[model samples]
Target: MNKKQKKVLTRIIIASVLMIILVLLPLEDYPLVRFILFMVPYFTVGYDILLKAFKGIKNKQVFDENFLMAIATVGAIALGEYTEGVAVMLFYQIGELFQSYAVGKSRRNISQLMDIRPDFANVMVDGVLEQVDPDDVEIGSEIVVQPGEKIPIDGVVIDGNATLDTAALTGESVPRTAKIGDEVISGCINMSGVLTIRTTKEFGESTVSKILDLVENASSKKSKPENFISKFARIYTPVVCYSALALAVIPPVVRLIMGIDPLWTQWVYRALTFLVISCPCALVISIPLTFFAGIGGASRAGVLVKGSNYLDALSRSKIVVMDKTGTLTKGVFEVTKVQAVDISEEELLEMTAMAEAFSNHPISRSLKEAYGKPIDTSLVSDVEEISGHGVKANVSGKVVQVGNEKLMNSIGVQVEDIVEPGTVIHVAIDGKYHGYILISDMLKEHSKEAIIGLKRAGISKTVMLTGDSKKVADLVAADLGLDEVCAELLPGDKVSKVEELLATKTDKEQLIFVGDGINDAPVLSRADIGVAMGALGSDAAIEAADVVLMDDDPSSIVKAIGISKKCMRIVYENIYFAIGIKVACLILGAVGIANMWIAIFADVGVMVLAVLNAIRALSVKKYK
Candidate 1:
């Protein structure tokens, strides 16, 4: 508990004990003594609330919760309901204490998840290492990360190798091995060995900074449910207060004018009870707290939801359109089959690796990786890379061509057909077609489980959109049990397809598009809810997305959607329970069927129960 809450609890305990002692004494026989003893507990328990009420009145905020509570309790005391009044004030304070505790707990959870920022870095200056703030380290500086230290910036490794613990960023337990020439992201801990990384991005533009920004500002965007409650409270509080006033005076005035018993005190007491029962405290507090807890829980799992608005939209999503490469698939390619026409497999592999050594394309890297040995660049002469086609080189005094069918056909080399669903690189030696290397991208480990999880989470449709060949897209879709597949689409074509799907959405349905490419930016921005697979995605995708999956796992998407639906359900339950109980008790209180004790239950007791329900949003197992 905070200092203020601790002090309040102390005062409440002391006051309650003093009141109990005085009540057991013979003070009832002395009316003045009894009143003074009663006033002791009343002042002790309710002084803060009275002070807040006065402040609200002075500040022109007279219709606030504190004012309503103070008026109702004081009026109850005037009607000789001392015990009920004191009990009501004390319980209301306790409810406020509970709310403060829940807020503190949620803040702690979010802070722990966002504590991935590194303080300093070891920069190499004139061949000597110097410690400096991460922000002070410039781009292109060589930073040395020791064992057990977090990588301070996004960069490529120039030397050394190590195992990286990426759970802080990705929520994945698997430790990735980083070697020379591989990129290492910020906020990942180096588990073993040392690494010398050449920084390629500034500290402000690093992954950790971007993630922190997204999380810290998540609640600023309002969701529909939260907005509705806010608007309801603003109008409901004033209307109920004025109605309670009318209930107190109108009937008694009419009775007096008609020569009947006024029953002024009875009607006034009922009005006080009505005010206590009608306070909108429960609805105002619980609904937003539920959303805050939901957002915080998602952050702990490395999923950054931009706001509650997107959270609400994600909860209603029925059709989920996903990208294939880098999202459903691992995006890692390998040479699976090699077919030679005129030359052998060994000759084709050697020539392809030599020609691709100068290029940095993933396909080129896969071909070079297939060789699995050091290449003697002396054998590669006159190397030229042709954009959108392939590469040309001179190897061992023979002209070598390594490219696609277009590259071979352009050079008058007859290409043979291959029946694989991947990019085929044609190889020709001295203007003669030798062979082709068939490389395929592998599927992610959890792709199938993610699809199943989505179905279990009540998603009605699953689709895959990709720029890959029709055969490749269909194979992946079938393996994952997807309902629809659209392949070989350019970036603009993907946006048009998404628009058409959006047009078919009903009032109860939402369209969610997931992607991880710069080419997928337009579709990601055009969907009802855009989820970016952040791990391997381009910066453009992240900026245009509503939610970012830090781990790049498709299963996290299902978890996110499930959590959102559970949160929305909890929000509605709190709203209905709070408003329903309060309205029912308000009617009973005005008719004198219920007392001030019951009004206390309607105001504070209901608030505590609703808060407990809101905390359930933080528990993922409850939804699962």
Candidate 2:
């Protein structure tokens, strides 16, 4: 327990001992002396409550839980129920202690998940190892990460090989093998062997920093239910306070007017009990806690939710729209087939590779990788990239074009329509159609399972949006059993399509767009909930996305949705259980049928039960 909680516990123990002694003493004849003795222990365990009530009244912020607690216990003492008054405060303190401990436990769990922040990065400076802050390490600087040390910065492995413990980053227990030329993200522990890496991004832009930032600011964006509770409490507390006052005074006045005895003390005592039962502690505390636990649970499963608002929206998502490359498919392109019209296959490859050599697009890299030789950049000059079309470059003093069918037609070349189920790159040289290469990307092993999982989870429509050919998109969509497919779209067209889908969905439902490329950032931001494939996702897309899947597994998306639904269920349960019980007991308390013990159960007991239910949001194994 924290020091404050320990101190509160100590006070509770001391007060309980004193209260027991007071109850055993025969001080009925010396009422004044007995009152003074009881007051000593009463103030000891509950001074903070009274102090807070005073402060709230002074600040014109009355009618909070503290105020209600103070008024209820003080009124009990005034009615000569000193033992009940102290017991009420003691049990309330115990409940608060439980709440503090529970919240601290959940925060610690989240902190451990995000404990990947590096203390320092080891950089070789002037032939010596100098440990410096990761933020100070410049891009391209050689940093050495020894065995059992965290990879302090995102970079490329330049020397040595090791099995990386990526559980902290990806929540996968299996260790990943990293060798020279392989890209490694920050926050992963190097399990074995010393490794040298060339830093590629600054610390602020690294994966670890982005995740930490996401978690730290998550609470600022409250969910709809949380917002509703906040506003409800602001109005509910004041209205209840006035109702309690009316119960105390108006009932006695009505009895006097009806010629019956005005039992003022009895009605006042009932009003105090009514106030205790009406305290909104359960709804105020558990709703936000449920969402917090859900976020922590998702982080442990390698899914990071940026805010509770997204968590709430994800629970209501009925339509899931996803990008084709890197999201569902492995996004690794390979040259499956090459057709030559008027030249040999080697000549066609040479011209295509030379035109795409300077580009970093996955398809370009695949063509260059197929060529398997260094490009003579001197022969490839004046490279121009046409948006959504292809690349135009002067290859070997000949104007060569490498792109889609649109690019071939834009250059006034008569290109034959090739019906294929892969990303086709049409090549034209000196205004004549040369040939085409079919580069295909393999789908992720879990992509089909992920789609089925979403459908089983009650997603009404599964859509695939892509820039690939209609045949390739239709093939992937059919194989995955998607409800809709929109192909041959550029980045702008993607945002427009997302907007159209967004308009089609009901207000009660949300649309989720998942992507991984730099161009996907626009659509990611436009959708209701943007899910990014963080492992291979571009920084732009990650920054724009509301949720990030660290393992790049499409199946985790369904897991995330499940977590969201579970959290919302817990939240609503707490709200209903707390309010329903409070309202029932409030009615009984006003009618004088309930006493202090029953009031305590309605207030503190209900809060403790609600809190325990909120903790269930941390359980992800059930959803898995």
Candidate 3:
């Protein structure tokens, strides 16, 4: 417990002891002394609430639970039910103490998330290490990280090698090896050798800063259920207060009109009980607590949800649309097959590598890597790249055309059909068909499990959308067991395809799109819930996405869905449970069948139970 909770707990204990002492005293002979002793316990247990009630009344906000509790207990005191009034206040304070502790427990997760905030950054100054604020570190500056120190900014390793513990950033316990030229994001702990890194991004624009900002602002975006409870409390409180007033007055007037002696105290007592039952504390506190715990739990699992609204929407998602590259696959291309017609395989590869040596495209890099030798620029001349087709160049005094079938056809070369399930690059020398090189991307180790997990989580369909050829897309879709495939789409076409899918889905069902490329940003924003592979995803895509999987593992998507489902379940359960019990007790209190002790159960007891259930949202690992 926090200091305030401990203090409140102390007050509760003291008030209970005083009440017990008064109950034991001979109070019949000393009625004035008995009243004084009762007031002592009452004021001791509830002085803060009474003061708050008076302050709320002075500020023209007179309908809160504080006011309700103060008036109910004060009315009981005025009716000579001193012990019952003190007990109500004492138990109410106990409930408030429980609420404070529960909220603190939930907020501690967010505080642990904030632990990633760097206290200081080590920058190199004239061969000397200097400690500086992370925010003051400029881009392109060299920062030195020692063993067991957090990387203070996103940067590339320029000097040393080390293993990094990325648990703070990605929740992955496995330590990752980092070497020269590898990019390391901020918030990772350098676990071994010392490293010097050249900062690629300013501290404010770094990954750690963005994630902290995302988590801090999440509570502002409340879910539909939370908003409804907020509105319900606003309208329900005043209406119930007026209704209780009428309950106290109208029934007593009716008794008088019937020529019977009006039992004013009996009717008034029921009104006070009604006021206590109608506090709306359970619904107001538990719904938002459920979502907050879910977000915290997801963060611990390396899924960063931007807000509760997205978390709620994810629970209702039916279809998942995914980008093929980087999301499900390793996204790194490698030469898997080589086909040569007139010349040997080495000859075709060397020619293609010579033609692509001047280009920096991923496919070009794969071809160059396959050759595994540096290109002699003197042997290559007149290099020209045809947009959307291929590259044309003269290598060793021989003209070579290396590209797709479209380039071979345009150059008057009859390209042979290759029924390969990979990206095929056609090679032609001196306008004659040479062959094709098949470069394929490897799938992620967990990609198949991710699809199965999604299906198990109740996702109705899984679809793959990619700019890759139909043959490659279909092969990947079949391998991953996807329900549908959309291939050869540009960035804009992907958006249109998502729109078509959205139109086909039920109105209440959501379509979630996951991607990890700059081109995927548009489609990410277009989907109902956008999940990004943050570790390797582009900054734009990460910014556009609603949720981020920090380790770039596709399986975390299913885990995120599981967390959302659990959270929403808790939210709905609390809503139904609190409202069901409250409505039943309100009716009983209005008819004088329930008294102050029952009122405490209906209000404070219900809130404590709902809060305990809401805390269940933090235990989301089993759901995965």
lDDT (0 to 1) per candidate = 0.86, 0.90, 0.89
Q: Please provide, for model 3 over 1-624, each residue's C-alpha lDDT reduced to its tens digit, 9 standing for 90 to 100.
A: 878888999999999999999888879788777788899989998999999999999999988899989988999888888888998899899888898899899899667854687888998788889999999999999999999899989999999999998876777788899999999988888889999999999998888888788888888888899899999998999898999899999999999999988899999999999988898989998999899988888887788889999999999999999999988998899999998997999989999999888899999999999999988878888999999899999999999999988999998888667766788899989988888999999889999999999999999999999999898899899999999999999889999999999999998999999998466888889999998875532478558989888887889899899999999999999999999998999999998899988999999999999999999888767343
Candidate 2 lDDT over residue span 394-449, tens digit each: 98789999998788778788777776668789988898887899998988988999
* Cα RMSD to the true fold for all candidates: 3.2, 4.9, 2.7
How much is 622 displaced in model 2, in angstroms? 6.6
TM-score of each: 0.90, 0.87, 0.92
The number of clashing residue pairs in model 1 is 0
Candidate 1 stretches with Cα past 4 Å from truth are 122-132, 142-144, 158-160, 257-259, 340-348, 351-361, 376-417, 426-436, 536-538, 621-624
**What TM value does model 2 have?**
0.87
After the best TM-score superposition of candidate 2, give how far the Cα of residue 16 lies from its true spot, in angstroms: 1.7
For 13-116, candidate 1 gives per-residue lDDT tens digits of: 87788767876787666877776778888889889899999998899888878888899989887877777777778888888888889878878876776678
Q: Count backbone clashes in candidate 2.
A: 0
Q: Candidate 1: deviation at residue 233, Å?
A: 1.0
Can you rank all candidates by TM-score, best first? 3, 1, 2
After superposing candidate 3 on the true structure, give the runs of residues whose Cα lies further than 4 Å from its correct spot: 339-359, 371-403, 406-416, 426-435, 535-537, 622-624
> How accurate locally is residue 357 in candidate 2, as Cα lDDT from 0 to 100?
85
Query: Candidate 1: TM-score?
Result: 0.90
